[model samples]
Target: MVSEIHLSDDLGDSNLTVSDFANTLDAAIRTLLEEQSTGLIAGGKISNKLVELEIPEKLVVIGDIHGDLRALHNILKKIKIDKFVLNHNNKIIFLGDYVDRGLGSIEVLYTICSLKIQHPHSVVLMRGNHEAPVEFPISSHDLPKRMTERFGRRIGTEIYQTKIMDLFHLLYLITIIKGELFLVHGGVPTDLSNITMKFNEIVPNETGLFGDMLEEILWNDPRILPDGKDWENSRRGLGKHFSSNVSKNWLSISKTKVIVRGHEPCNGFKLDHDGMVLTLFSCNEAYPKFSVGYISTSGIRLHSIRNGFDLSEMVKIL
Candidate 1:
């Protein structure tokens, strides 16, 4: 049975004061920094921008929110996340891209951050490419502009620099559900051999190999063509487009069955690389032609699942 989770009425409302917004951003930044310093431990352990956990009994997997506060709210209500967390063993993973491309980026960030503060153990926030500009700058970035428009120049600029940028640096890069699944904002690195070694102790802004790996995790996308090369230069200009064989080999190396990510816009969700990759797009406002959806299932069921095609059956489309 699902119980009701009452969200703040002012979350997406214009009535929310600038001071309140700043305070929430500050509180969230503090929470993330503290988590970074001390490590986050619920059932899983998060350290060095990587989250590792045993598959929970029940799990809710959300994709790119892209500032859709209504979508986020709907998912939370539909999943009964507040009630689900009461079990302590259940978890929810947000596959990044939380802000940008929509009108309510500030509200979306605030809501997720508030959820993290309220249920530190039950919620995991991963970093998306939209959240990667502090390191790998992208030309299409509009978050700063959105902030300035919403809160005015001086205060908004300060918030984006001090509060949001700091918070972005602290978001987790990837989450591993032990041998069950690999969750990231984008796609896998082309070189699977170095993954285990590099991901063990990753620094978000490091140069050379680690930097390259970070870029791929945040910007890459899976190549859907069956005959495509193992790796091809992505049209996105930053990450490589990996083929099905790469996905298979990477999964074998990581000991995970499926790669779950969110960087592409599709109708609800998409399966690529022979169902080895699941790309979920959960915001309709960003791509009006695309449907929004998320995955809600037990970790046990995920462990038994062989591919994204099978997993698609569990998606809850809104």
Candidate 2:
């Protein structure tokens, strides 16, 4: 019922547009990431350095993190997980967009994956649209390599290739929590009903396709502008692809009234459509793009996950 909420569904007889759906999906990624980032910071889980597996007091969700190992490190450090886990337990939810744009995505994901393995039960990893073969190569299809070529040398390539590559296959585009919060890398598609992202557990060669049963977790986002306000993301393909198209279409489908995402950059966490949707970019001051987000049952929060600025509390419910 919660995941069934979408704006497109309300329009019933109307057609869904890819442009709108893309924008909406992008925004959704940011929203969920914002939820995960600080949630990890406010970790109230019960894991020990030597022990494994424990219950969680809260869920820490992270937003889109391009290959910025530095920003990723900062986010992990900034999370006040210990503070939250004092009485309540907690878990970490990574909402996808883990690769591309920045140089260190390969390492970033591996680091997170390492954490997931170390803290197994406490970590949740979702897949983003960029996790495909087109994203990992050292050539043109790979933005991580391109960014690295412009920046400097990365610490480890083989480690990322071997260790992190395995996790990529196991990630999901969307991850729903307690059946209350819908977490996806992209926005939902119209007619998305009873769809689920099984990324909480990582396995080899598992995947979801695009269509009525679209990869909502990896495909959804919030609308870029207010109702009747047009927005264009040149960075994306002429505002027709998921960057703009699909988002609008999906927004109209869900019944939740509002969607969240992590693909775009915002001066800070933002709300549009009279609060119908929320957008939060998790990395700040990242090489090319940066944004971070934090979300919880109470509300959503935003923060800057970059090096220039010390990791600070971007968003907090309490």
Best by lDDT: 1
How does candidate 2 fare on TM-score? 0.53
* lDDT of prediction 2: 0.43
TM-score, one value per model: 0.90, 0.53
lDDT of each: 0.80, 0.43
| Models, CA RMSD each | 3.6, 15.8
Give a tens-digit lDDT track for model 1, residues 124-207. 888888888565657535788988888899988998888888788778887889887889899888875666675554644343
lDDT of 2 by residue, 129-177 (tens): 6764333232312643643343334523432344344445545444433
